[model samples]
Target chain A: MSTVAVMNGNYAAATAARLARPEVIAAYPITPQTPVVEYLTLFAAEGSLSSRMTEVESEHSAMSILSGASLAGARCYTATSSQGLALMYEPYFRASTLRLPIVMNIVNREMISPQSVWGGPQDSLTLRDAGWIQIYVEDNQEILDQTIQAFRIAEDPRVLLPINVCYDGFYLSHMTERVEVPEQAEIDAFLPPYEAKHQILDPRKPMAIDPLTSGYLVMEYRKKHMDSMAAALGVVEETDKAYAALTGRSWGGALDLYRMEDAEYAVVTLGSVTGACREMVDEKRAAGVRIGLVKVRCLRPFPKAAVAAALARVKGFGVIDRNVSFGWNTGIVYQEVRSALYESGRTLPSVPFVGGLGGEDITLGLVSKAFDEIVAAVDAGRTPQSAVWLWAPRKGVKA
Target chain B: MSALDLLAEREDMISPGISACVGCNVELTLRTVMKVLGPNSILAIPPGCMGGVGVVGWNKQSGAKVPVFFPLLDNTASMLAGIRLALDAKGRDAHVVAFAGDGATVDAGFQALSGVAERGDRIIYICYDNEGYMNTGYQRSSSTSKGSWTSTTPVSKEGQGGKRQHGKDFPMIMAMHDVPYVATASPAYIPDLVRKVEEAMKVKEGLAYIHVYNPCLTGWGIRAEESISVARLAVKTRFFPLYEARNRKFKITVPVPNPLPLEDYTSRIKKFSHLGPERIAELKDLAEERYRFLEAVSAGGGGRA
Candidate 1:
């Protein structure tokens, strides 16, 4: 008996975490992510959630508790956004390298300096090089589904790397949507109890954890850890296949192709922006336009091969990045996709359009402007030399 | 049971082939601690010398008899709290202990330490206060005594010898958290330290903070054999008074009625060799201030600073 309730993104995420029955949950409050923590504390207080809720002082301790708990061989869950994630970088860096399969929800928000608490992917995007697997979702239902799947993917023997289930903050985290919450038993069947095969804190064993290493042995650890990321590419497919077999809803591997079969031009998007682009693609398809959308779900172990294969035949493509790469003068995802395509030796004229920054809306008009740029690049037989900024004053620093 | 016999009954938890220098006081403290706690406890060691970062480096053997978790540098308190809470959730009463250095406890890790104490999380949080960032070459820490030398606080030509502020009264600060157990111990007095450990183990509820004065031979520029003597003189001079805060009321566990002069303790360690008479008098004044504060707490006046 699955409960289908209209729930906000935070509730959907909290609901999934609750059903997973994490042994330990720790988190600190930041805007857009605070509701998830609040809901978890209430669940723990009301006895609806059976887990040790560690109300830590800061996000650093929040991730630290999860790290220690996971080392204790307990399934742990936590969430944070923007500065909270920034504060927890210490433990966050260790969680993946130590191969602790802890699942954390990242309600994407803008980083500070300008001091904005709105939705943007800049937070998680900044940590793209960090060892954790990054999964961006398009909607609340997908948020609920992918969170449960994140545990399976992170804990799989092939890839015992931690994963951040990132979704747009206000757009998805605050927006309400009808989510089909699965039954506890069904989720239990999908995701088995977390058994730490990698490392465990057992007094009986009396082994050393994180001992100091010289350069030679340190290379082996680094290589082995990196090898796990490549293996994640395969584990992600199989895990999603297993989930698809259960729920009859499958996100097309890492790069979800939308009306791309024979399209002459394409636009790539991630997080919540993918949903709006999907609507645009459907409209374009109905009007006999050759435009399509490519939803990028996995940012790390970046579905390079899949992305290459999807866009190999297209005349041109554009990447809509909600985050800036700073010095590169383009979006972070656009830079990644361009690198992936370049590595694959596929030369398609590309448009790197950065919009929806700092929770600024990436409306249909802005997306249309992006699509036009991609088509213009293809028709002119040239790629844009720099990124096109949308929905902003014309007077900011270039890039 | 005799405390000596109780200590002798247990095996040496520190592997004999460990990397700690001879007469390392931290090694003595760890061995004595493991002897009392037995093999049932779990230790959450952070990136500190005691956890094998610098002085007593851990390798495959790790010199541990029980499970040891090395949390990040500033996360020992949260890690211990997490491990203990996780055990409690599983209906296990296994002891959780945090052995951290001054850098991890008094300064960088203070927030998490205070947070867990407010929650009254059951764990033995021992700050092996060697007084500075000893493992990182004796830089000044919040626990470094006033008028003492450190890499960051060197003697200047202007006649300044060391840190200007008094060494933070960390254990007293912990007592202010109103925790069930807060005590200061020194490795120089084994039986007293063992007694405090036993008492903390008995209470077995809420956070138990033990600020153990661990003399660093390398960092303090003292002879390895002088570690214990230096620690003993520290207590004899009333510089590091051995006391316990029970139910927010303080009591001097080992009182020194006719305390030795501060020079007796300062003379044993090279870290304080540059202190002039003026600095020595200031040091004596700070210890007196601490004594007055301890006396107020002993009279059940809430230990107000």
Candidate 2:
């Protein structure tokens, strides 16, 4: 049994966490992500969720508190955005290294310096190698469903790693959409009661949880963590099927292919921008252009084989990134997509385009323009000259 | 509790073969604290000499028979608070403790410590005061006493090898939080420290804080044998007064009548050898000011109870 309601992404994520019934939730308030915390507090206050809510001083303390709770054998949760996520970097890495299956919602906001509160995937993509199983959500419905499934994948006996379910701030987090939230009974059946296998702070069986591993064993711990991530790659698919069997919905497991069959060229994207890409593909297809979209959902435990196989038949692909991997000039996803292609001996005329940054509108027009560049590059029989930056303000030219 | 009971705890709870140096007062404090905390204890040890020395190491056998968790240096209190709440939620009676040092408690970790106290978290926070950041090679911590020589406050000029800023009055600060229990114990006084730990373990209301005086031989430039003597002089001279605050009622646990001169305590440690008699008098004034403040707040109402 599930209820259909018009809700924002944060509310959907909060509903999922409530249904999942986390034992402990410690989070600090940050822009675009505060509503999730607020909603959880409402659940705790209204006698809905029995989760213990710990209001912390900073993002660092929030993660640290959750780490303690998770290691002590409890299902834990927390939420943060850009700077808040960066502030939690220390314990964020520790949470994964300690193998605590904590689920965090990162309402993706642009990283600052020229301070911005806008939506972007850069914040979560930057921590891809932090030993967290990161997945980007397409919309509010996906946000709700994936968060419930994330616990199942994260707490898997073979993959006791943290999960960062990222959804673009404001674009999806603040925007209301129709989300079908499953019943608590369905959630329980989907995500069984968390039983920790690795470590639990029990007095009867006393043992050090995170001990000082020697240099000799440091590699051993890292190997195990990485192997757990590899295991999660498989668990992500299996759990998505399980979640669909329970809820009648799936997040396309790892990567979502949008009309790529017999397509001449495709562009890779994730998050809300994927919505624009899908629209662009439809418009281009109606106009007799063979343009397609590949939404790389799981950035960590990256679907290299899945992506490679998806692109193996396609002729040319362009990567539309909302983030720029500085100095590398290419976008973060561009590097991974290119590697996936080269690994399978299938390098096409790939172009990396940076757009929709700092909440800038990544409209249907901009996505279509990126697809045009891919088509032109394929026709020219050459790769793009350089990475393209869209919707730039002309210097010294007013409006 | 009987002395035999405490001794039995020593034999049973404290694991041997730790690599701590001779006369490491923190090691003695840890061994005794663990005895009272028992097997049902889960210790969140932060980055400090007590945690790093012989208690835990690279693939080495842990010096704790009970569960030990290594949290970051500055977030021990909050970490232990999380562990405490988790155990509480599970209906488990595990006593979670944060074993930290002067640097971790007063300097880097002060914000987290204050956060835990403000949240009224139920955990025993034992700070083994070693004066400075001795774990990182005798660096000057905010708790490093005024006119104490640390590597960071080295002597650049002749006869000037001490920090000018006074160290934070941390225990009194904890008492100000009006926590369930706030006490100061000395490693030299095992039974008294044991009593404080037992009291803290019984606290189901909120936080319990114990600031134990553990003199560092390496940082203080004192010989190994001088550790206990130094600890004793610290209490006798009113430098480190033993006290407890419960329910906002304060008490001076160890009375110091006709206290020793400040130099009688400082002169033995080479780190304070650069301080002249005049500077020692200044330190004495500071110690007296703190003691007077504590006395004023005592439930005994001004003077020795």
Instruction: Name the candidate that leads on lDDT.
Output: 2
Candidate 2 chain A worst ten-residue window by lDDT: A390-399
Residue-level lDDT of model 1, residues A1-399, one tens digit each, is 677899999999999899889999988999999999999988888988998887778999988888878887788899999999999888898888888888999999999879899999899999988899999999999999999999899888889889999999999999998999888899989888888767777666665577666678778888998999999988888888998888877987687998889899999999998877888887777777799888898998799889888888898899999999888899899888888889888788888888897899999878777777788888898877778877745576664
Q: What is the per-residue lDDT of model 1 for residues B1-305, given as tens digits with 9 covering 90 to 100?
A: 66699887888765666566677898788788888888887877677676663322243446566777677778888887777767776677677888888899999999999998998888888889999887668899999988778888888866566887888899989999999999999999999999999888976678898999987999888898788999898899989999998768788888777889998888888878888888899999999888877876684452323
RMSD of 2: 1.7
Quick one: best TM-score, which candidate? 2
Model 2 local distance difference test score: 0.86
lDDT of 2 by residue, B1-305 (tens): 58557766455565576767887888888888887887888887787786676464346456577777788877888788788778877878788898899888998788888899988989899998888888789988888888888899987578876798998899989988889999999988888898899999989978999999888898888899888889999999999999999968998888786788878889889888888888888889999998888888887765376
For model 1, report DockQ. Answer: 0.59
TM-score of chain A of 1: 0.97
- How far in Å is the alpha carbon of B173 misplaced in model 1? 0.2
What TM-score fits each model?
Answer: 0.96, 0.97
Candidate 1 regions with alpha-carbon error over 4 angstroms: A392-399, B53-61, B157-159, B299-305
Model 2 share of native interface contacts: 0.62
Over A55-154, each residue of candidate 2 has an lDDT whose tens digit, in order, gives 8888889998988888889899888999999988988999999999999999999999778998998898999999999999889999998998899999
lDDT of each: 0.85, 0.86
